[model samples]
Target: MATEHGIPKLRIVEPSFDSPLTSVIIDLEKLRDNRLDSKTHPGIFFQIKHIFQLLESLGSARIEGNNTTIAELVEKEISGSRNDDEIIGDDEINEIRNAERAMDFIESRIKNNSKIDQAFILNLHKIVVE
Candidate 1:
């Protein structure tokens, strides 16, 4: 891979299945399968998914230097926006919102069996930027 400025971008390949990292992958997969197979109520599962989406948004924004806390995210979500005196910037909030929306968009794509490729990625990017 290469950067937009034409610099080569180093890609990290996954560890071989025989490596110690493979055990982590196996454990995670088993945990995921167990969660999916559990007899949780639909509403409870929905809430779990919602919470995870928030965390996903939080982590994504943090990578870009967004300092919004999970508590603030919940408050902003409840109020639909923040006041002028709020410490967080509008752009930061928007980034978090975009990340959350992107996750939803991906979920929908997967549900609809949409092709996952460059176009799909670009579409997600367009959704996030817009």
Candidate 2:
């Protein structure tokens, strides 16, 4: 391609349009170099659509919210059982039981509220990305 100074810019070959969006690899540097300030670029538009599609795809792995479960709390209890001896006294056991109750409450909310899973996953995303 011709440049501003009439020099040739390297031609970047386009990938097949037949492939899925998941197969597309975005060039963040090239995108930011030109697109960070440009509003009308299809690159940014498609990327956002791609991201939204990905987030929507998460609904696929979703558990049936119709069931009652505090899987996280249950998992915590199971994990804690692995180191059972670490709890030395009746007081500590009571504390652990209290924690378990709190987890159960959170789990109940997760099971009942339709929006809870999305928020939980979003929080998980923030934690992971941060």
| Residue 102 C-alpha lDDT in model 2 | 40
Each model's TM-score, in the order given? 0.67, 0.21
Candidate 2: tens digits of C-alpha lDDT, residues 8-106? 676866767665542545544456468354566788887776445433323322332222233532454467552433443434233434333344445
- Go through the candidates in order and give each one's C-alpha lDDT: 0.81, 0.46
Q: Write the per-residue lDDT of candidate 1 for residues 24-110, one digit (tens) a residue.
A: 888888886563466889899999988888898899889988899988788887885654234345787878877777888999999
Top candidate on lDDT is: 1
Per-structure clash totals for the candidates: 0, 0
| Worst 10-residue lDDT window, candidate 1 | 80-89
Residue 106 CA displacement from its true place in model 1, Å: 0.9
In candidate 2, stretches whose alpha carbon ends up further than 4 angstroms from where it belongs are 1-89, 114-130
